[model samples]
Target: MTDVEPSTEITGNMQQLIAAKAEELFNLCDTEQKGFIIKKDMQRLRDELGVEPEQLEDVFDSLDIDHNGYLTLEEFTSGFGMFLGDQIDDGNANEQEMIEHNPNDKEEQQLFHDTLEALGAKDLYDDEETIMGLWMKLRENDPVLLRQFEQFIGKITQEIRRSKLDHRSIEAALHSKSSVHESEIKKLYDEMEQQIKAEKAKVLAQEKLKERELREQMDRELRLKEQQLSELTKKQSDLEMKLLRLNLNESETKSENERLQKGLKNLANI
Candidate 1:
């Protein structure tokens, strides 16, 4: 039933009729006066009230909005609004067709009052606003349309629930993948860091080895320089000694030549 706006006007007689039906259904369904009726007990209402089996599910679902499996007077009255205007079938082609219950009929009048007394909706009967409010809650005139609306709402609700579940599943999968990727990235970073440290250590060790080699080479060069200097000093001292011996030999030769010249001059005088 397509829910229409409650813009329809209720004449005084129409008000009385709706009130009577509301009270009747309430009493019939809530016979125990427990203030509510279970889904099973609603079969009486479905059978007697001329509600179709297919439509009943939607009606039950709509009336039992709380999903508590029971119908209060308020819920029952709202359901009554669905079937109030006309007979629940294709036989009555006129949407304007209304059941005219005579207020003057003694049996029907007493039944309406008895229903009110049993259910305590006397205030509802007296107040036009309250009765209209209940009537206005019905959006659709056709039972099939009303049931279709209910089914449509049910489908939409189901879809919403399914979407929420899907969203949660996607979030969980993304979270799992994110966690795995983060772990892999951290492992790779750690391996890279270790490799860098090892390379640095290797390079540092090589540099240190090169420095030691250079130091050893310098020490050897210094020792060779010292040895060459010692040998040159020893050679200079030996050259000085040889020059002194040559000077002494030259002086002795000059003295012997002078002595020989004096001997030759004495022999010429003899």
Candidate 2:
């Protein structure tokens, strides 16, 4: 059987598959529903994937790209791609090389050159200082563009790692002449779909419950307010009645005083 290398499209699909699996593993580890995973969560991954503690620690460190004591989804996905690349290469050679390699190395410089060519900025490649100045300018003036550029570079790097991982698997699948690998891929996707649906349903149910509770509380408050309004109306009516009675009593007393003054005047004339 002829050896076959995976195409770019195939590599992308495999990367997506790996990312999906990583997300699933991340969700499992993050049992508390925190959006990020801490080092403590690595234990869950080790338990589930049956990886060694030391290996898990190494993976966690590599995956936490920002070293912020937590792993975001993007970091986990990209780091897992690299880890799979290492696995495909049959050892920690690639990982060790990455650790030992200098940023100013020829290969790294070549990568920058290729990147500049791809970006149609080859004119800037000859002047490292200019490139640095441009990068700093973007960072300061156009932060969003800088962020997008960083993300694009990260994706390209991740794709390269995934291609290396998929290369051997594609070759093996071609040699075996069996559909087992395809079937496994399908099964994993099906499971992931079901799990995602279940999680969505759970969230919907919680939201509905929250809405119902809020509606009930609002209804109770409305009823209490209505009752208080009714009591206030009654109190106001009682006060108005008391005021009318007081006015009537004052009129009666004034009339009786006027009559006594007239009788006293007649007695004075007699």
Candidate 3:
């Protein structure tokens, strides 16, 4: 809820309980014997929770720390207390209170609200529920933008933790730091765009070259076939001409033989 380190907050026994519960749920959901639970596998749970598909998807994504679409037992175990432990009616009112508490200082809270506003989240607050709801909305509407914001927040959180600055210094530091980060991000984005364009152009050129080569190969094949066909046609014509000449010679020989036979017959009669 507060995005604090679970190791710092969850007791050893609590962690064990969460791990056991996570294993039970993971086993129950993984009915297909795939050793992992996918979105479809969590349908019954989703229906039971009465949450929308997008919300369920967000939960799943959170549990799936590797973003690999499948939640393994280890991943589920590690993330269950952070994400799904609230769903269970553990009768721990204190845990709920802890989750709802605003861990951020006033400056940090203002920065959080301002960042949410910049990201188009309305009616923002420092409370966990409001922030989470907005996150879900952001994930559904513009996941790419949400991811960018998450990166920025992660960086800022790290900086704040490392420096341990007073509340007053935080606002000025955040503004200055955020400005520098935004500039770096914009420059990186432009570079990535240029790289993408170059890669696309290279791919298009390769495709076009391949297409041209294929066309030329087909043309060469066609010409080879034509050449072979012409040779065959000439051979056929030559054979036909030779057969006609043999036929004419045979006719001439037969006529001469007939005339000779007639002469022989006349001589015999004489």
Candidate 4:
């Protein structure tokens, strides 16, 4: 006999709905939260619910809001409600439903990058501890339901990859723009440096020429002053010799007058 499908069971491949549920499930399963189960490993959820693995298949059907086959926080939380919430109150149905993510959501786009980074960082998907831990945490008891969740995860991962490709394209465009701007700035800077150096050289050459002219003027003035000094010394020597000759002539005249006076006295006495 074919296995009777439960009314509560839902299809796992709905991209719009079930994938979101898987992420939430993983968050709850994250080590920090003891109450959460990781769908990557559904045994944990099974253990938490204390239910057989087959029972989890109904989780997808019962929680699907849009029938898009993807589960949102509400659906997954509804799944978790069986195991984790000790509180009697239903937390926030309307708010949970509003959290539905379409492929175009920017935040979800960011989440795709983050998830890839996370997977790269931990290598958790490849390691056995985390995988087994995931199993123990969300799937051990409900093996069949775990398969459905896995189906949903595969669907989301494909979307995530596509999101990453689009993101890369945009990133490449931005990098190209940045490179162009940097090149322009460098060219401008180089031109300015060259102009400044040329101006400085011109100023230096002009200053040197002015100094040469000033030095030439100074030398010419010194030569003129030296020639004047030499002429003045020769004139002073000639004047000194003329004064000596005039003194000698005056002495001779005085001696002659004395002699004439003596002769006159002698005649008178005779």
Off by over 4 Å in 2: 1-178
Candidate 3: give the clashing pairs.
Answer: none
Worst 10 residues of 4 by lDDT: 6-15
Pairs clashing within candidate 2: none
Taking the tens digit of each residue's C-alpha lDDT, what string does model 3 give over 79-133? Answer: 6655632323342553444345445456646765666555444252233343443
lDDT of 1 by residue, 1-270 (tens): 223322234344334454455667678767788988887666666654456765666667876877888888776765655544322222123232322212234664465455344443444433333232222233323445534334323343444557778999999999999999999999999999999999999999999999999999999999999999999988888888787778777877877887888889889899
User: All candidates' TM-scores?
Assistant: 0.39, 0.34, 0.37, 0.38
Per-model tally of clashing residue pairs: 6, 0, 0, 28
Superposition error at 249 for model 1 (Å): 4.4
lDDT of 4: 0.51
lDDT of 2 by residue, 1-270 (tens): 113322435334444555666787789878988888988788886545556777678779977877899997777766765554422222234333323332344664576566656654555223333233233444545665455444444444455557766987888878665577778888999999999999999999999999999999999999999999999999999999999999999999999999999999999999
Candidate 3 Cα lDDT to native: 0.63
Off by over 4 Å in 4: 1-166, 255-270
Q: List model 4 lDDT by residue over 1-270, tens digit each.
A: 112221211212122243455455555445455443333345455554445655554554544545665544445655544332111133233212212211244564464445445444223223222222222333435555445434444544555667788899889988988898898899999999999999999999999999999999999999999999999988888888888778888888888888889989999999
Top-TM-score candidate index = 1
- Runs of candidate 3 with Cα error greater than 4 angstroms are 1-173
What shift in Å separates residue 10 of candidate 2 from its native position after superposition?
A: 40
TM-score between candidate 2 and the true structure: 0.34
